[model samples]
Target: MTPQPFVAMKNIEKSFNGVPVLKSVTLEVEEGEIHALLGENGAGKSTLMNILGGVHQPDNGTILINGEEAKMADPRVSQEHGISFIHQELNMVSDLKVYENMFLGSELRNKFGFLAVEEMCRQTHEILAELGVNINPKEYVRNLATSYKQLIEISKALLHKSRLIIMDEPTTSLAEHEVNRLFELMKNLKKTGVSIIYISHKLKEIQAVCDRYTVLRDGQLVKTGMVENEDLETITKMMVGKAISQERFMHEHPFGETAMEVSGLTSTGHFKDIDFTVRKGEIVGFTGLAGDGRTELFESLFGFRKKYAGEVKINGQVVKIDHPRKALQAGIGYVPKDRKENAIIKDLSVIHNMSLSSMGNFERSGFIQDKKEREKFDVYKKALNIKVHNPRITIDKLSGGNQQKVIIAKWLEAETDILIFDNPTQGIDVGAKQEIYQQIIALSRLGKAIIILSSEAPEVLRICHTINVMYHGEITARFTGEGASEEEIMHYATGSKREGIAIG
Candidate 1:
């Protein structure tokens, strides 16, 4: 008799609101092998994983473990079957301690029914040490960094003695060193006969860590094969259905006078002595690794951090923006990072979300003009090629790329002369990214000043006219899009090199 694969999800199908997300998908994981689930955003990766995690039931499928059909009615049942899921947005409670979060729902108790705090802490320390994480088990999760929080999530999976672990974008927030550490830990886990289903958009990391690969496109399984047999381009083609171009998008534009200027911008602990100028009809970019202060600097510029000391000028006039309303009034609009948390209102309709920032334009006699809002939405919907069945549905029902388009439309309607987009295409896929880049270039051609803050060097290189690198709250390097290389940017982003003189 032949041995069975550790886990097999066969003929899975799922749909939402009459739209199929997963269609007869089959995934098999061998024990001790690191399997990759690759797909573009909205390619049904999340839907299939949610089914395996017991967050949703498949319309038709069989989940087998060790060749026996199994039923996973809920998350608890999945846990009982030795399946663990670590989500992209972590599920840890900030107020709780490390060990407390480790054993949150399934707590250890003594024979008298008393909580076994010491035993839990000891176990947490042992697991963390295996991953080279050195931290107090009693420390509050709120004080930990994002990477530490990510490790805690991974550790929780181990605590469950999970035979099969599902990691979704596990290294998104990790730095280079931390990511290396995680790779080592994953290797060790594999050596111990644990199977891992790794899901991520970072192709380089997927190539490095994944043993086998499965590509999904348009809710169907496109291919399943060994990672060693395929190249990045081939995998990307399977995911997006076409080859994605990596050409530079910066071209000669009729740039107008400087639209926004910042001099001596300093916020004690966040960012310091920042100076830069963004001209009308040009797109400037800020790129760096985690903790480079790019996000904080932009947040302060957008008036979210009022305690900052800086000289901000708009169209060559000094302006004071102590709040977002003032920033908007000054013709400076900010599209914040982490769109789900900072930009969109989940409960609102798609049209309402698009018109939120420019509500006054749709109001008559202190009442909203629904007809006018709908008309405007239709224009943007067509312009952006947004995929939505109905404008009345909730915005959360849309894909990541479509939701981002709606947010961009909202700011465009506000007629802000200068737009600051922080990680505009963070969770979006390659095909949708081309459309977004085109839209941004069109905006710049119309004489709107743009600032894009991104962590990805290639993204900044592809879109921006000028690129600025930040490190430890300082501007470390500047380059024209024509000359900036990823290696050059990384040297400054990691604080390996710096310029002596102030530049703007």
Candidate 2:
């Protein structure tokens, strides 16, 4: 006989500005089950999960917890019901001590209503120890590594004694070994009767940890099935709702000229002893597992991360990059991974975001931001095919694909000779992805030096003139056009040793 589910959501529909983002989605999770919610970028998976967490109210739906109907009016209401969401973007206050962060707003108070600091720290310490994470609960969260902070966040959820835990892209900032540890922790938690809803773009991890997967695409339920019953290909097809040409994004170009050079570049906790060069008219894809430090390397180059050890030069001339402003001065443009967090101000208009980074160009006497200066932004705005009635509408209303296009537009409007795109196609649909690649190729043809860091192997193989495999804070293998092979890169990236490789 089938047991009644612990939590169930039925016929959930959500919309923003009259656009349907989630349509009649149904999902059920039993106690002790690790259910994965699978979908491509902007596929309403996040929306559905957000609705469950009381982050957003669904337009139409019924939510049931243990056969009892409930409407969560706030995140606290959801938490009171033993449901907690660990967002992909870590939200713990960095300046606060770890213990303070863990028990934030839920602090235990003494008889006089004063904060019981030591009591909270002791409990936090015990929890961290139980999770097999080595750290003092009193340590500052900002000083800790990303992987450790994530573990702390997980510990925070467990502190609530949550019955249903939803983790959104929790693996993005973890090291390879750390990911393994997390999977083990998740499995152990599942055995203890805690239901987990895990969401991620990393396909391989889903195959290992999830028992069942509920796929969402274009705001509707595509299907729900057991993970053990499906292979990666089937899962991919379901996520996209059709056969997507996975290989269409790959087409290497014949790159030319040394466009940018880095020598002995280093930054604390970000990158160390980095040295590489990008050629004009070529796409050089940088691939490594999450937390392998690929993004850090670019951040260092872009002047966001201060360079403490080495030098960067463009076209064989030494450039001074003391800051991000200096990096742009050196003709380098960067598109960050999280479009909302790093790339876009969602409250601004589409053209506003597109023109933001390049706004300095239109300034007159350092005062007025000329309206005519926006003409430069319009060129790329139309070129990228942004879906908007006008550039004056706030950016948050556009689709994920259009938001990404505006980010690209922000960089293109800058007169940068070299560009670094970090996971530029992360959360968009197939057609938008195709259009983005087209834009990239167009940039390469215009002799822009492009360096892309992507998890998708085929995306790397298709666009890059040269591919660099990074592992454990070093470049493991450098593959050129003819020699580029996915198997070789993966093996090296996964820590397989090859001769003639030593911290290169």
Candidate 3:
């Protein structure tokens, strides 16, 4: 008898707006196997996962469970098939308690037919305990840290009796220790025969947790085989169909006076006594595994955090920036991590959004707009290769990568001396990542002081003039050219006690 695979999909075909997303892509996941799905952004990796999770129905495909055909008409239907998905965007009610959030749809009913609060809390605690997750199930999700929220989302999959778990960029927002805990849990679950399909851009993660992999390129199958002996170079080659190089890194020009300075930068519990300096023309990359207060640090620096207590200095002049508007007026440009939330305006015209920050420069007599505004917009639009129907069209219509370029364009128009890029390449395609990387170095070459907060290790190594490692609101270690070691950095990042790590 032929032993059936635990899950299989044959000849999957899907498209969006007549563009082929998945073309004749077939995948199989044996029982208890961790299948690593690989692809550049928009290479049909997301589409395939979406179909499996009932988020989208394939135009043509056959899904089989234990060799028997199955129907996945909707997310609920997919859930019924014992498939639970943890998306990069955690969908949890912030106001609700963890226990209530866990028992959300299936609240335990007491004998009187009321909500069984005690029973639900007991079950949530049991689930958390079994997974070795140290969390109070009754605490409000908003009160818990972002890492704890991530664990809750993953645990929800287990509570649903899901045999096939699909995690998409699960650690994109987790701290170092939290990521290790998550990885350990993944191994434990796999030992118990639960299949995990992890999708991410972190190559090291795939190499560590995945035993087998399937590579996708331009909406087609490039390779599918066991991950054993499959190095990052090989996986990358299949995904991009080319060699990945570090040619974008350039020599640092002589830094001038301090372009920006922060003295005793603190935001209560988030970050404290954060002293840093960015010299003119220097690209200082502030890096840590996500949730190391990198984002919060920048937010405070840009005056987005009201409770922040810090002194900002530009060109050796101390200034108080009490709001984002004040920060922009002080010649500071900040490009946020979440493109949708912080950068682009969906309904606005591309030209309009690009010129928004510098609108006053484009206005005359406090009423009339000038052609110079459009010329400014076209300069960045063409330089960044922003794809759109027209400059007058909406900004949100572009792809993920294109949208990010628009965000940068908005800040570039402001002509700020100090640029704050918080995970600028997060969720963008590989090709787009390369493009943005080149732009970062370009900005530095133009004598713009750039500060980058990134989770991807390769990105920091490739562009930063110097690197600083942060842990629990403290600068743990600093690395200079040729001295930056990934292993040593990870050791301090993951809370190791050993010392002797160097600082640039």
Question: Model 2 off-target regions past 4 Å?
Answer: 110-113, 129-136, 142-149, 248-252, 264-275, 289-296, 305-311, 338-340, 359-406, 426-435, 454-459, 471-473, 494-498, 501-504
Residue range 1-504, candidate 2, lDDT tens digits: 788798899999887778778889999999999998887666777678888999899889899999899998889889999998887656789899999999898999999999999999999988888767789888898798766888888888878888889998776656666778788888988999999999977778899899999988777888888999998878888886666555634555566789898888766675566778888887878988765678878877777666468877888898867688887777888887766556779787777787787667777787636476567656665565555656787887665556777887787667688888887776554545656777888888888988898876777877777788877667777887457677877887877854544332
Q: Write the per-residue lDDT of candidate 1 for residues 166-192, one digit (tens) a residue.
A: 998787656677788888988988999
The CA lDDT of each predicted structure is 0.87, 0.79, 0.78
**Which candidate should be chosen as best, given TM-score against the real structure?**
1
lDDT for predicted candidate 3 compared with the true structure:
0.78
Model 1 misplaced regions, further than 4 Å: 94-98, 118-151, 365-372, 375-387, 399-405, 501-504
| lDDT per residue (tens digit) for residues 348-460 in model 3 | 88788888877777888886374787777677766665555467768754544566677777776677899988887776656557767777778788889989888766678
List TM-score per model, in order. 0.91, 0.84, 0.85
Single out the weakest 10-residue window by summed lDDT for candidate 2: 495-504
- What RMSD does each model have against the real structure? 2.7, 4.0, 3.9
Better of 1 and 2 by TM-score: 1
